[model samples]
Target chain A: MPSIDVCYSPELLHLYELEGKAVVAVDILRATSTMVTAFAHGATDIIPVMQLEECRAYAEQGCLTAAERNGIKAEGFDLGNSPFAYMNGQVKDRTVAITTTNGTRAIRMSEAAQEIIVGAFLNLEAVAQHLRELQLDVLVVCAGWKGKFNLEDTLYAGALAERLQGEFEFENDATLASLYLYHAAKDDMVTFLRQSSHVRRLENLEIHKDIEFCLQHDTYNVLPVWKRDRLVNLKEFESLGV
Target chain B: MPSIDVCYSPELLHLYELEGKAVVAVDILRATSTMVTAFAHGATDIIPVMQLEECRAYAEQGCLTAAERNGIKAEGFDLGNSPFAYMNGQVKDRTVAITTTNGTRAIRMSEAAQEIIVGAFLNLEAVAQHLRELQLDVLVVCAGWKGKFNLEDTLYAGALAERLQGEFEFENDATLASLYLYHAAKDDMVTFLRQSSHVRRLENLEIHKDIEFCLQHDTYNVLPVWKRDRLVNLKEFESLGV
Candidate 1:
């Protein structure tokens, strides 16, 4: 069986040996959620940039720019971190260059992996099924807030670990730990994660609904794969060399 | 009210503005566990070093060295990471330099904080009480395995968040999410975390019992604080400007 290692934060990515593994990057709080939602709603691809200017520069390629900070949309950007904005129908067939406080950084950091797939609660099922089918060693990269572990990412990792358990062997303790947390809290995942520091911070912003919505599992089955400096549907890779 | 931020991994430490917060470094796996047990058994002080060689260097200070890897006692070390080892009267009145994979790294990373308290299930109450006595903002830093997020650390963060709900304001949604997780898992925290990646990794090494022991709450009231490249007993910090 293929083995999987779970990296709970972006900083831990370097500690992980991902030379040949398929890296499943997760940012459940909003980035991955937004990406999956965007794809599911018909966006063509997302060019993930670590810097705000890089995202702005993508505009030269006719790409839409989405930026966010502290839960609010960044001014002068075409989109925000909110998933609803990605679903506004203006995203269909459009290419988006995106930058956020945490998720994009994680995606950029995992570039060395043999393959990288965007994972979120919305697209979890797709990610799991894809991993099981590929039968490659997997690494679940959680884009914690600014390189720190946050609940949404770990829970997503736990959920994936739980789903992928029978088909894969967990290579590290983090993989098993996350699966255990999810198994124990799956029944009331949203309630269980409500007190997490990141969620509490968002609550202060009155975005509790986003927290509740992001926790929903397997809501969409879109698989966004990193390719050509962007995350597009896996089909984009199949056309190249996935 | 003081605010509590549960950082699931040390990597997320940068996201927090530590300018004036009292950071609680939680490593439930064994570092905090051993520290608390060491103090409970009357150890004069516990020094936490991120590197094994640092532990050896501290040994030059006329202290014992307790090093652990893969949950096993390392060769040439006076002690392993087991809480029982520290509580078995081997650590009383002795100065020890301890090294472990996760907790020690967490302490080192938290050196940037205004204050850093070593926390675990065993010392949750003491940590909470200690934090309550101090009016500064608080950040719960989870020393996850190798810079990754682990369920054990986040659960401890959640547990502490639940305990301090009335006394602190949550700085973010992550805190609220962790508190929710703690509440959901409170009935059987040990069992809830049994499947965590960290515990499972340890279980493969036949140390599931350690996981159970690490989750026991209020087993001791010893608070460990970071100082001069080590996490020593809080009392040791009376002269360090704490």
Candidate 2:
């Protein structure tokens, strides 16, 4: 049986060998949630850049740019790290280049993975189904806040692990811990996460709506997968049967 | 109020600011447990060295040496990483020089902390009471398996956090997550930890007794603290009124 492991922070990514395994980069506070929302709203592809300048440069190539730093929209970027900004035709038929505090860095660091996909509570089932179809060893890499463990991303990893249960062998203590945390928070994640430092930080910024929106289960049926240079909707790609 | 945080692995210790805080280094699957037991058995002090050679060098100074690598006692060492090895007059009134794969390294890495103390289920309340008395910010450093997250140590951290609740603020998600894990495992830690990777590794070596012994709560009324170059029992030192 293929093994499932959870790496609580991207800074610890080097500990795991990523060769031939599927890596799911999760930043549920908003980056991956926003990316999944963008694809559901007709975004063509997403280029995850590490710097604000890199994201802004994509605007020259006719790609919609999203940049966030410390949970706020960066100066001169078209969008911040909010899923609401990706809806209602703002991202229709367009490509997106994005940069955020934690999420984009996780995707950039997972360059050695066999396949890298974005994961969020918004598209949890979609990511799980794709992994099941791929049938490979899976590693859920949480984009923890500032290279430290965060509650939201870990709960998302647990939710994913719970979905992939029985099919994947959780061989590490981190995965077991995550599954426990997921079960503890699954019934009322918003209330359970109210004590989280990151949640408090976001609440101080008055992005409570984003927190509630991002925590909703299976709101989007999209799997944004890494292909060559950018993330394209894998579900749509597979539907074309190419 | 001071804060309580959990650093799940020593490899991520750099992310935390340990300057004025009390760091409780916990390795529940036996290193810290052994140290606490040694102090309880009348050991004068413990010098935790990084290398086996360093620990072995202490033997020439008439100090007892204990070393373990990959869960086995190193050759020629007077003791392995087992609490039972310290009982029955083995460590009485003697200084111990110890090295371990995870625990000793965690103590060494936390050099920046204002005070470093050994924590295990064996000395849970003793360590917690010492922290309450010290009135300092606490960082529970789990000496996880090879710098990766492990279950038993995090559960120990959660147990400590639960005891210190209402006095210390849990400002990080790691602490919150650990508290949840502790609540999940508090009823029957032995059964809950059967799936832990390190527990399984030790069980393979037939150290099932060590696992059960290390998981017992408040077995020792001792707190081994770092003072100058070695760990001495803080409860005894405080009784001297020094």
All models: lDDT? Answer: 0.78, 0.90
Question: DockQ, in order, for the candidates?
Answer: 0.37, 0.82
* Residue-level lDDT tens digits of model 1 in A101-213: 89888888988888999998877778999998888899988887766657678778888888887788875657765665677678887766765667767778887777777
Per-residue CA lDDT of candidate 2, range B175-209, in tens? Answer: 99999999999999999999988899899999998
Worst 10 residues of 1 chain B by lDDT: B233-242
- Span of 10 residues, lowest total lDDT, candidate 2 chain B: B233-242
Q: What is the lDDT of residue B155 in candidate 1?
A: 79
My TM-score estimates for the predictions, one after another, are 0.78, 0.97
lDDT of 1 by residue, B94-210 (tens): 998888887877777777788889888887887888899998899888887766656677778888888888888874656655665676678987776765666767888887777
Off by over 4 Å in 2: A237-242, B237-242
